[model samples]
Target: MTKLLNVAGAISLLLGFIVSSNAVAVDEQPQSLSQLQSLGNNNQNISNSSLQQGTFNKTNRSGVLLPGEASAQELLPAAEEGLPPPFGANLFAGGYESERSDGLNDDYVVAPGDKVSVWLWGAVNQSEVLTVDNQSNLFITNVGPINVANVKASQLNQVVTERIKQVYKSSVSIYVNLLTATPVSVYITGSVIRPGQYAGVASDSVLYYLKRAGGIDSERGSYRSVKVLRNNEVIKEIDLYDFVLGGYLPRFNFKDGDVILVERQQATILVTGSVRNPFRFELDKDESIGTDLIKIARPYAKVSHVGVVGDRADGPFSIYVPFAEFAQFQLKDGDRVFFNDDIRAQIFDIQVAGSYLGPSYFAVKKDTRLYDLLAHIEVDPNLADFQSVYIQRKSVAQKQKELIDQSLERLERSVFTAPASSDGEASIRLQEGQMILQFTERARKIVPLGKVVIAENGKIANVLLEQGDIVHIPAKSDLVQVGGEVMMPQALVYNENATVEDYIAWAGGYSERANYEQIMVINPNGMVRLNATGALKPGDQILVLPKVDAKIMQNVKDITQIIYQIAVAANAIK
Candidate 1:
C-alpha cells in the first residue's frame, strides 16, 4: 500500500509540474495559443545566459559559421533506429497563427439566428436563452420582436436595457449578453488573391475571411494597411507591424454586409540578409521608418543590428542602426535595409614560435602590437638576437611571393635580350642566371617572422596582429669567433662547456694590450654582451677587447654598432 501511494504521488507531481510550467494568462483565445507555442520554441533555442520570454524568438548563435569552415552535416553520427523529429515547426507568413485569429470574434453584434442570454429581476424573475429571428430582431415570450442587427457591441447593453424597460414599465432590471453571433456573408475585395463573398461567423476576426478569400496577394497587396468598411464607412484598419512589435491587433466585429479592403501596396522597400523573406515589401508612404521595415521583413530576432543603404548627394552610403534605435530613424525612397548579426569574437589568436621562452599560441584583443607581445614573452638576454627580431604573417608571405614572381618574369625577359659577344654569350648568361637565382631564392624564402615590425620609436608599434601569426626568435649559432686584441685572432667550435677565458686561451691567450674588463660576447641573434662569462652555444661570437682610454664610451658604442650589423647579416643570410 505504501509503495503504491508513493508511485501515485510521484505521477501527480510530474503532471502538476508540466501544467504549471506551461501556464500563462492571456486575454484572447488565439493570442494565448500562439504565445504558448512561441514560448516553447523560444525556451528550447535560447542561450543559457538569458531568460526565455517575449514573443520574439531566442537568439540561436550556432548559425553564424562562415563558408569553407567545418560544419555538423559532414560529421553527423549514425542515427538511431527510430527517433522523433525536432520540436517546433517552420514559421512563415499566413501560417497556423494567422489562420487561427481569423475565427469568430467574441464582440460580434447580435444578428439574426444568434443566441442571446436574457434574465429579468425585481418585477418578473426569469432566465432564458432567446434566439434572434431572420428579420434581425429577438422575440421574447411576452414581448414582441426588438431590432438589434446594425448596432455596435458597445451599444448592445443600452439597446437591450431600453427594450426591456418598455415591456416591464421600469420595474424590472435586465441582464442580456450575446451568446453567439449568426453566420455573416462578408465580401472581401481589392489587392487579394481571391476577392469574393465568404460565409462565416459574424464575430470572426478579419483574418478568417481573408484566408477564406485566399491570402492577400503578396506581390500586390499592402500588409501594412488593411481596412474593413460597413455601409460605405471605414470601420477598422489593420497593421501587421503591430503584431511583430509585440501582440497588437485591431478589435472589430464582422457584420453581414461588411467589406474588407486590402489597399494596394504603394511604396516598395528592399530587405535582405538574415530575414525570413528577402523580398521587397510594398508598403504605404506613411510607413518609412526602420521599425516599419522590420515588421515586413520578419528577420531573425537575434539580428538586432540593421544597416540601411541609400544614395546621397555625395554618392551611396550605409548607416548601422541598433534594434533599440529603429524607431528613431526614417527611411527614404530607393533605400535597401540589411539585418545583420554581431560577430561573437573580440580577440585574435597569435603564436610565439622559434626560440622564445614563453607560452605559444594564445589570444589577445585586437590592435595588439609585436612590442606588446615581446614584453609579455620572455627572451634570454644572453642568447636572443633582439635587433634581428621580426613578426611574420602567412598572408603577408603569400603576397610577397606573388610580387617576387612577377619581378622575376620581367627580369628574365630583359636578361635574355641583353647585348653580348657571341663567344661570351654563354658566360654572360651563366653570370646573370646566378644573380637572378640568388635574388629569386631571397624572394621565395619567407622568414619565420614575416617582416612585420612595430616602430622602434615606441616599444609597442602600430602593427596589428592576426590569428595564426608567428613571432620568431632565431636559434643560437655555432663557431664562436674571437677577434680584437687577441694574440691570435681565431674562431673555435662553440661548446656549452666553454667559458670566455677558455675561448681566449684557445686564441693563444689574450695579448698584453687586451682589456680584460672589456671582454665582449656577440650572440648570433644580435645580442651584445659586455664582460659575459656564461658558457656559449654553437656559433656564439666572442671578441677580446683592446685597451682603449681614448673616449672609452665612444669606442664601445662603435664596437656595439659594428658587431650588431655582423650578427644581423649572419641571421639574414640563413
Candidate 2:
C-alpha cells in the first residue's frame, strides 16, 4: 500500500514538471504570444544543441555512421516550393516606432487627464498649467471652470481666447496651448506577432502600437482586414495596401482601452514576373479581377499578355490572353497570374567590339545577316582582320558549359566509385580522388569564350545574327604567342614559315611536365588544331598542354580528355 502511494506521488511530480515547463505566463494572466513563442524557441534550441553534442560524442566513441543523422543530412529541398511572401509583409518592421509623434494632431479631441496651458498677459498678467478634471473642464483663477474637453487641438486656442474676451474686451491677449496629451493603454491582439497591451499617447497612430506589439503576423494576418476596435465595436477597418500602393494611411486618434486587431488572412492571388512588386496579394473582395491586382502589382515593363492559372470546378484550368482582356477576367482564390512581355520585338540590339569606327552598337532587325551588319561597319582596312572575324554568343557559351559539366560529372562518378581491393589501394584512391575533385572544381570556373568559327578558307560566313551577339573584328597582329607548359611564355615576331614546334622552341621549349605529343595550335578566331604539323599564322597562339600521370590508366585518360576539352572551349591553358 505504501509502495503504491510512493509510485503515485512520483507520477504526480513528473506530470507537474511537464505542465510547468509549457507555461509561458508568470501568473494566470494573458501574455504576449510572440514572447511565449520566443521563450519556447530558446528552450528548443537548448535541447537541440544538447542532443547534437551527445550525438557527436557517441559518433566519436564508435566509428560508425548513424541512420538518423545520415538521412537528415541527405534530405533535399524542393524547387519553387511555395508562393512568394505577401506584399506589405515588411511594413511594420519597427521603423514606424522611430517616427512616433509626441505632439497631438490638429483634429485630436481633448479628453480628460490632458493638460492645457493658459496665459492672460495684457489686461491682467496671469498664467496657469491646468489638467482637465473628471468633469472635462479646466479651472482658472480669474476665469472660473471652462469646458475644454472633446475640443479639437486646432480650435482650442480660439475657444479659450473667445472665453477670455468675454471678461476683458480690450488690452487682454490670451494664449492657449496644449502642454501634454493623455497617455492611453491600447490592446494589440489577433494575428499579431506579440498580442499585448501597449502604452502610448491618445494621438498615436495605429501603426505606433502595432509596431510596439512586434508587428502583424505576415503569413496569417490580413493586410486588408486590420480593424481598430473601441469597446468591442470596430470603429475603423484599415487596409495596409492603401499605404503601400499610395502613401495614404487614415488618421484616427486612439483612445484608452482601444483594440488594434489584425484579422486572419483572406483570399489571395500570386503575382509574378515583370512586375515591380512580385508578391502574393490579399483580395479586398472574393470576386476581384485582374484589374484590382494591376493597381498594386504595378508591372514595371510593358505587359504584352498575362497567363492566369487556378483550380476551377472543371479541375486545374489556365488562360492566356492579351493585357486588354485581362481586366475582364474574374479571379478566384489561389490563382497565379504571370505578366509576360511576350511579343517579340522586330528590332534587337547587337554590340561590335575591336577595330571598328563610329557607334559600336547597332539596333538591327531580327533577321539581319552578318554581312548586312559588316557592310555598315566602318573600319580601317590596315588594322581590321576581316577574314578572321568571329561571333561570340551567350547561348553557345551556355551550351558549352553544360557539355563540359556533364563530362566532369561522369569522370567524378567513375573515379570515386572505383572499388579498392586493399587498405593501401583505398588510401591511394582517396588521394587521387581529392586531386581530381580539385581539378574539376577549377575547370568548372572556366567561362568559354563561345567563339563561333565563322571564318573558313579565308572567308567570313554570312550567318543570321541573334540578339546580344558580339561581332569582334580581330586587329591585324605581327606577333605569335606561346604559353602553358613552356619555360618562357612570350610573344615572338611573326614567322609565316614557322611550324607549331618552332614557336614552342623559340619560347624556351616545353617544361618537363609538358605533353609534347598533345600540342595545341589556336588561331585568333578560336580554331584549334591538335597537331605540330599545322601551318602557323601571325597572331596565332600555341599552348603546350601538361601531361597527366596517374596510377590508374583510366584516370589519366579522363583527366587528359577534360584538359583537352577546356582548351578547345575556352582557348586557355587550364
Model 2, 1-574: lDDT tens digits are: 3433332232222111100000001122322212222333222112211112111111111212344422211211111466688898777755777665765789888988888999888869998899989898888887788898678899999988888788789998889998788888999999999999998888787777888988878788888999999989999989988898888899878888999999999999888777898888999887697788888899855566677767888897666666777877799987888886666655557788888776777766677766666666666768877667778887777777787788899899998899999997887677667666666776677676567777644556666778777888889899998877788989999887887788889989887667778888878766777875757888887877776554343466776777677767655462
| Predicted model with the maximum TM-score | 2
275-320: candidate 1 lDDT, tens digit per residue = 7766666556844877777766778966765666667668865566
lDDT of 1: 0.57
**In model 2, how large is the Cα lDDT of residue 344?**
67
> What overall lDDT, based on C-alpha atoms, would model 2 receive against the true structure?
0.72
Q: Which stretches of candidate 2 lie over 4 Å from their true place?
A: 1-80, 98-107, 119-125, 168-174, 231-233, 300-302, 313-315, 550-554
Q: What is the C-alpha lDDT of each candidate?
A: 0.57, 0.72
Residue 361, candidate 1: how far off, in angstroms?
A: 12
